[model samples]
Target: MARILLADDDEATRDLVKRALETDGHTVSITQDGAEALDTLTSAAATFDVLVSDVHMPGLDGVALAKRAIAAAPDLKLLLMSGFAEELDRAQALKSANLGVIIKPFTLDQIRAAVRALLA
Candidate 1:
């Protein structure tokens, strides 16, 4: 099982994702914003295998968090989620070879596959 850090401003969405990932046997740590997510990624005693974050957080959007998180945890696998077209485009423009974008309204299997792709 993989250790995961998940961030999303929406409480319901965060909870749903946490549960879904946990049900898949991944250990997940959840945060409400990118700043918190970054803090956890940089300060956690244990290393996370994946970072799944929403792109529209209030402080430190997902893309920015990904930048800092990669510096803090170079091996981190990143998967970003966004419902907006503009945000998705921004994520794509990032063009990091290790970055993956999971469009909103995606199935749980899609999320699992995205992370697996990065990890693989």
Candidate 2:
């Protein structure tokens, strides 16, 4: 089991992802946007093993968040989600060993597997 931090602006997406990961026995903490997720990552008492975030968000986008999160916690793993090809391309540009990307409209199993890949 892993301690995961998940960030997505959409409530339904957030809830669906939270449940999907939890079903896989991972402890998930959620935030509505990247800024909040960053706060949780930097200030929270508990250190997260992985970060699952949406690529497009209001204030701080997932790509920016990923960059900052990695700097703050070098060992943190990243899984970014997006339906847009351009955004996915942006996420891929980071090119970190611990980073991964999932397309939106994903099945629960797909998301679970993506997170599992990062953990593995």
Query: How much does each candidate deviate from the true structure in C-alpha RMSD?
Result: 1.3, 0.7
Single out the weakest 10-residue window by summed lDDT for candidate 2: 38-47
TM-score of each model, in listed order: 0.92, 0.98
- Model 1: ten consecutive residues of lowest lDDT: 38-47
Q: Over the stretch 17-111, how does candidate 1's per-residue lDDT look in tens digits?
A: 88788887999999999988888887848689899999999979998998888788777888999999899888888777778999898887888
Residue pairs of candidate 2 with colliding backbone atoms: none
Candidate 2 structure quality by residue, lDDT tens digits, 45-119: 969999999999999999999999989998999999999999999999998999999998899999999999999
For model 2, the superposed segments whose C-alpha errors exceed 4 Å read none
Question: How many times do residue backbones clash in model 1?
Answer: 0
Shift of residue 94 alpha carbon in model 2, Å: 0.5
Superposition error at 112 for model 2 (Å): 0.3
User: lDDT per model, in order?
Assistant: 0.87, 0.96
